[model samples]
Target: MPKILLLFAHPRYEQSRTNHALLRGVGELAEVTFHDLYEAYPEFDIDVAYEKKLLLEHDVIVWHHPFYWYSCPPLLKQWIDVVLEFNWAYGPKGNALADKTCLQVITTGGGSEVYCSAGRNNYSINTFLRPFEQTARLCGMRYLPPYAVTGTHKLTDEELRQHADEYHRILISLRENASVADLKDCEFQDDIPPQLTIS
Candidate 1:
């Protein structure tokens, strides 16, 4: 089984029911490591060496958070800026993250319908996620189609359960061999490539 580093970040985790329930389902899986960024460093002072070590240890890295202002929470942006060093995570000498897999698991208050061309958001979630996706590419990591749990504001108990169930299923699928080729089997899933090459 692949080792997964689930980097969770939410400013107001206490108020979260959807993300929390989703987390509860995945927190106990084998080879899954949970790291809450805000809980770890409330002051935003990240330890680079230690964070790099975690990246090295895991085969798959998951960024779990609620979509904030069409992107990630601030701490996540901070983590990427601080933890992924130039010569260590990229550049000629930076190959620490080469071939690793990175996936984004996000929760959104808006329904999926509103994230399309005709939707109020005016773009897909994947569109807003390009920055992250490209960053993963630069680090030589494969960026998988994001696993999204949308419509939190309107999700019924059964709907939330279904989303959580699919979440578990995708995590299991990724722990094995992961490729965008497999994304085709999932129709409603986004249109990310089978393999992404960093330029």
Candidate 2:
């Protein structure tokens, strides 16, 4: 059985319409543990030991957040700094996350077409996500294809609901008892359509 630990970070979740709906819709599942970093560490003081424990328990680790400055929210960077420690998360004596999987679930205010060389953002979403992929690689973790939901600001109600449902399905596919072929099929490489996790 695989345990999924979802690390959710949104500084102003209240002011958000799209991300809020996405998170809420997916929060109802059985084994999906959503850890709200902002709510958990309002003071910015993260308990590293406890967090490593969570990582140790879960088979897959998900960093869920909005695209803040083409990267993650500050709290997530802080979490990575504190939780993924040397001699614990990497380097000699570190094997905590060696075989575990790390995946990012992100929602962006920008449109998909705009995140390109000729676009305003001037980079693809996957290009901006290389750091995460490399980070997973450094820790000997399998970085799966990320789940990206774009154009949040313009999402219609039906579009939002559709994406929310897709989000739920993706998470459910990672939960304990989900098959291995399901995991392999997702082969994340950035800016791709949804993966077919099952037959």
Candidate 3:
């Protein structure tokens, strides 16, 4: 079983309906360490050593956040910049994160339809997440297609619960060391078939 380090970041978590529910769903799951970046470093001061240690300790790293301005919140970006150093995360000698897995769990305010070449956003969610994909690539990590919850503004409580249930199942699958090889070619895990049906 892979130990998942779920790093969540949201500036205004209290006001978020979808993200709040998603967080609650996985808060007590075993073998998944839920670390809230904003709650841990409200002042934006990240502990580089500790963060790197965390990276080394976990088999899977999950960056959970709301899609802010088509990307992640500032603190997660800062953590990447500061903790993933040149020689440690991505240099000729850096192999700490090699062979590990990375997953992004994001909530977007816009509907899924709005994030496409023909849509108002003019790009897909994966297109917008290229930087994150490249980061994993550079670190020799297998960047899995993201698990997204779109249309946040329109999702009802039950709809949100359904998505949250799926999120929990994804985490559990990862924890149980499920093979995600077939899912590598996918753009979004949410779009994959045979969706989890929880009553």
Candidate 4:
């Protein structure tokens, strides 16, 4: 199984029922190293060397967070700025992260209907995630579609549990390299075929 590094960033994680349930689903997975950015760097002082080391050790990197104003939280942005350096992650000599996989797991308060061309947001979730996709490309990582749990403000406990179960199954599929093909053409990892994710 490939080692998976899940970089989780949520400033107010304590208050988010969605994130809490998601974590509970996959927190004990043996192949996943769950790194909570907010917990580690409360002062916003990121250790670039340590962060790079973590990246080097993992085959798949997961950027898990809430959709904050169409992007990630401030600390995750800062981590991107400092950890992925010129001579390390992008430029000619920056081949350390080449051939790795990048996945995003996100939650949104808005419903899926509100994220389309004719909706309130006026753009798809994929359109809003272009920057993250480009970042993974620049680092030579294969970026997969995100796994999104939308309509979070009104999701029932049962709905939340189902999403959480699906998340756990998705992680297992990724770890075992069992469903990469199914994930490639999906707009969201949530669209992955149920059969492909059988654990």
Candidate 5:
């Protein structure tokens, strides 16, 4: 099983409903380590060495957060700015992250329909996630298709539970070393791997 490190960030975690539920579904997994950024570094002081140690120890890295202004929360961005050092994470001699896999799990208040070619957002969720993909690439990590939980403002109780279950299923599949090659062509999922059949 690939050790997974989840960098979870939420400025107002107590006020979150969807992201919290999604977190609860995967928090207890065997090889998944959860690092709550906001709770750990309230002052935005990221421990670069410690975070680098975690990255080196884990085979899969997940950035879990609510989509804020089409990007990540402030602390996560700050974490990236500090943790991903020049000669350590990327440079002539930096290759510690080679062959590692990175995935983004994000929640959005807007419905999936709003994030399309002619929609209000005017782009897919993946379009807004290019920065993350490029960051992973620069560090020699494989950027997997993002798992997006959308329409949080209107999710019913059953819908929320369904999404959470899907999140759990995906985590299990990833832990079991399931091949997500089918995920290459897509960039988003209502739950997880929307059209990619993983067993």
Candidate 6:
């Protein structure tokens, strides 16, 4: 099974019912390192060497956070600015992260329907995530479609639990069965086949 590194960032975790539910049982998964950025670096000072080490140790990297103001939280942005260095993550001799799979796991306040041409947001979620995709590409990682939970404000307890279960299943599939090819046509990880059959 591929080891997964989940970089979680949330400023107000205690108040977030959706994120709390989504991460209900993720910490217990074997070979999955759930690193809470806010908890680790409350001062917003990221440990570059340690972050790189964690990156090197994982086959799959997941940026799990709430979609804040059409982008990521400040700390996560800070992490990207410092941790993924030019000579180490992108430029010449920066092949350390080559072939790794990377994707975002996000939650949005608006519904999926609202992220379209006719909707209030006037663009898709994928459109808002281009920078993240480019960042992964620059690091020589395979950028997969994001796993998103939209309409967070209206989700009931049962709905949250179901989404949580689906999130768990997706992570398991990514760890044990799914490949880049298997995910190419998917618009979102939620669209992945239930069995996660590798083609």
- Give candidates' CA RMSD values in order: 2.6, 3.4, 4.6, 3.7, 3.5, 3.5
Worst 10-residue lDDT window for candidate 3 reads 190-199
In the range 1-199, model 1's lDDT, one tens digit per residue, is 6788999999999999898778775877777888999899888999888899999999889999999999999999999999999988899999999988888999999989999999999999999999999999899888878888888988998888777777776667677654555544543346675454211
lDDT of 1: 0.84
The number of residue pairs in model 4 that clash at the backbone is 0
Expressed as tens digits, the lDDT of each residue in 113-197 for candidate 3 is: 9987899999888888889988987998878778888989999899988887778877887888776653343335443233222
> What TM-score does structure 2 among the candidates reach?
0.89
Model 2 is weakest, by summed lDDT over 10 consecutive residues, at 190-199
Instruction: Name model 2 segments beyond 4 Å from true.
Output: 176-199
User: How close is every model to the real structure, measured as TM-score?
Assistant: 0.92, 0.89, 0.91, 0.92, 0.91, 0.91
**Candidate 6 lDDT tens digits, 87-149:** 899999888888888879999999999998999999888889889988988998877778889
Clashes of each: 0, 1, 0, 0, 0, 0
Candidate 2 displacement at residue 4 in angstroms: 0.5
lDDT value for model 2:
0.80
| TM-score (C-alpha, index-matched) for candidate 6 | 0.91
Against the true structure, candidate 4 reaches a TM-score of 0.92
Residues 44-139 of candidate 2: C-alpha lDDT, one tens digit per residue = 999888898888888888999999999999999999888888988889998889888777889999988898999999988888998987887788
- Candidate 5 clash pair list: none
Score each candidate by Cα lDDT. Answer: 0.84, 0.80, 0.84, 0.86, 0.84, 0.86
Off by over 4 Å in 1: 178-188, 196-199
Write down the lDDT that model 5 would get. Answer: 0.84
